[model samples]
Target: MIILFRIRRWLFKYIYHLIIILSLPLISLFSYNHLLNNHYHPKLINYTTLNQLYINNNTLFDNLFHSNKITSKFPISERSFSSLNDDVFQYGCRDPIMESSKNKRLNAAFVVLARNTEIDGVILSMRSLERRFNQWFNYPWIFLNDEPFNDEFKSRVEEVSSGEINFGLINSLNWHFPNNLENSPFFNEVVENQGDRGIMYGNMKSYHNMCRFYSGFFFEHPLIKDLEFYWRVEPDVEFYCDLTYDPFLEMKKNNKKYGFTITIKELINTVPNLFKLTNKFIIENNIKLPDTWSLFSNNMKFFKGENEINYKDVKNLDDFFRNLIKNTKYNYAKNVINNNNSDNDKQIPSKLLSKLNKLIINHSNSLPKSINEKFNDESYNLCHFWSNFEIASNELFTSPQYKAYYKFLEDSNGFFTERWGDAPIHSLAAGMFLNLSEIHYFRDIGYKHSTIGHCPYNSPNQLPYIPSDKFKHQVLPQDEIYMSEIDPPIKNPLINSNLGASGCRCRCPSDHREVENSGGSCSSLWLKLNDNNFPNSNSLTNHQLNLDLIENWALNSLMDWINNNGNIDDWEISQSERDLLSKNVI
Candidate 1:
């Protein structure tokens, strides 16, 4: 009886083993389908956990083999999962050195103007550039400081950077009071007495040196001389989106000479006589250049007697029109006004003259305010391209016109005595020498310095803090055709062309108008994602897309709301966790 019982147990064990082996393929099939179907989606967990499951720990053979039931609501498919392989990922990230063909293309590098004290902030900026744009480009970085970079600063920056890193000391001559000004009593007195002038950086000798270097010598630095294009990066600036294509390549292909992310009006006090100096330089140098509107030439022959032509002094509308054509200082100005006129000035109709007189009188008073009343033809309040973030062709600086312009400004000693910012200087040069077509506004770039900031995401779903003056800060003309705002979710054309166009259809039933009408902040953003007509709505279309990011952003919003509304402890919390926090131990 005992032997029979042992036989029965052995038979039962054999049957159980056989059944388990037979079900193995079925279990694998079910799990494979579950992964393929994207059913096991996690709702609200920290991004660390999500990244671990999604990005890092990709291999899960044990879990797949043991569990017969389908799990995992994550939307990842086989294609998405496999693409994260180191080789695939790195190749897609655009390492220019690896692609032999790109080497023969444009010579470009990132130029960082900073001091040794700003090394930490510089590293952060570099890391952001690498992750967003430069990793693929593998563009070299040139660091310039008025003072020599310390070893620690050099090593730390090198460690975080993937591309070639170069450190350069500003020429002592470039960073000090010029030989002409060093012995001047006036310069010394102004530097000493201007400390309390309330002008930003007006009194700092070092600041003057910094501005002078950028204006006259940054592009000429030996480390930067070979590159045809340089993207100026500042310490602590952030890049908000992924850049798939090479911006340098775009600039080269499109013949873009000057690119700026932000443009703001310079303080009037900072560049009080900048326009007078610029006009004098243009006139004295005999420089003539073509721009978007008309040819700007140092040829003052156009307005030789403009100030003397008193329109109000004319006796009648017919007399005003007659004198305007005959006594005008510039033939070009007269032709522009009288092209529609009849051949006989004597027979000019009263009706036409009345209209012409009104137009002249109205526009005469409404003309743009000029820095110098004598040079009212050229208005200058120092609207400049912020040099803090700029990308430009080397020719913009290296050309004869630009070189002469810089030399003229350098000789005047305005940089030392007044707080002349490099931004205004660069902007004025570009505006005068380069065509509007050559000047591009990088509206998509996320830029911030000190108190000001800008993001391309017009309605950001996830920014931690929004600048109060974001909408008010006028970087470009409101109606500028080329500088139009591209709504979020669409891959910035400046970043990627195909990715944005391939995004999903808007899933929202209501349009952007409806979303705006809703009037709630988060709700409006959410509805914008759903509005199909809205650009980049596909950025949020996928069910499992960026879920962790969204959740984290939502949590941040909740915390902010709670903080702004009342005490943090007002929210539901376990008594044990609170007690542990109060005692500093469990």
Candidate 2:
């Protein structure tokens, strides 16, 4: 009996040990799944649970993956998901159902500015837009060129376009340099210098003419003068997704004046005096700046320590104005003030002189604020909407305020001297004249110009796989070669549709981070400054919203770190690291 008891006890003990060993993998899988679910589906998990999970496992995963790099770079407190508000993520069509129902076609057209040589590129753009959105609405397309369109270009574009097409020649007065400066030696020298410096398209006089024309005169073209809205289309550019609804109508219904897919920082050298000139205009006109104007200004204190002047002190105020006027970049304004006919022969407008005097008087007592605060410094963040893919109301450009503003800049001859781009010109005008609510970010539109592009992904919980068979052999007629070369076979057919709604039949990869989430984009900053009047229509739950907010914050922090500490080109991921990242849900 004693021998039997000893054997049984030994067997029971060993069996229990064996059971625990066998169950370890199952326990591990459960734990991993729990963490992942919390990570991706913040909506499903409570805030307290997510915070606890982040606190415990963030350190453990630090070495496991570089995905944690963003969180690791910033302090845990600043990036904690718990600190973000639920409302920050709310944007876009405030009342989707209501807006969706009012589908009356807007009085809009796709305006393409191209040369005759760009027939093939124009057809590609026309066909893509037709297939994606214009076929259903049949919005007219108005084509304008510096010269008359040839028969071949017209025929090919009409053949591919779904809507009525009209071709027009740009007026010589509008397309060429102003008569006063056409042959000026100073103007010629500036153009030559710009080319020598390798500024983008600065060497090309036609490019400068194009920028100047678009900045001030395109909206008034005879072909499109009566039209209320226009979607600027460029040759060789692409629209990557199927737009299910009419964007023009959407803009009209929502009272949005401007819509864009990308916002980037403009090259500072291209517009050395743009901000200074813009600030001068703002103060002179006493224009009511938008609340979002703060995004453009760093709000750096102009005077520090003992140098700060009391607003009531007359001597101090005179000294400040004298320094400011002497330091100002508007030499044209100075010439007019000094009555230097040698520099500029035209008399300064009485209205302008009065406004200039008012500017000095108004700002004498105190330092200029808002757009005016950084007058002597590089105040502009250089953020601009890429005007190449703009959908905007014609009235925005044609408005009297804008026309005056453009004239002011044009008279300064900055277009020839500094190579001012239309993108920044349009952006600054939009920033000054329109409220944040008037601007719209087309998150759904996947657009590419030159080498840069924006591709939006599906939401996290949606269908994660894009069926490869759907796009395998599909190619637009005549676009087969270009399509094939640009879009290769999808190696990873997986996508997360639960994150956001991509356009219907979008062939582009839907798994990449959006431009708005990247460091280079100013869209997030734009949204952050959005007016609170818009209603919340985002369907994302609180936790899901928090996840997006956290991700954007982290990515921005990472980019800022890269810009300050190291070269972005030097920051690269290895194939192994990519593979590891691919295996895990980001």
What's every prediction's RMSD, in angstroms?
A: 26.8, 22.0
Each candidate's clash count: 12, 9
Off by over 4 Å in 2: 1-102, 302-373, 376-378, 459-497, 509-514, 531-586
lDDT per residue for candidate 2 within 14-47, as digits (tens), equals: 9999999999999987875543333111112122
List the candidate 1 regions with Cα displacement exceeding 4 Å: 1-105, 292-376, 458-586
Candidate 2, pairs of clashing residues = 458-500, 459-497, 459-498, 459-499, 459-500, 460-498, 460-499, 462-498, 464-495
Model 1 alpha-carbon miss at residue 448, Å: 1.9
Quantify all predictions' global Cα lDDT against the true fold. Answer: 0.52, 0.60
Per-residue lDDT of model 1, residues 33-101, tens digit only: 443333211122222332353222332222221112311332111011111101111112233334423
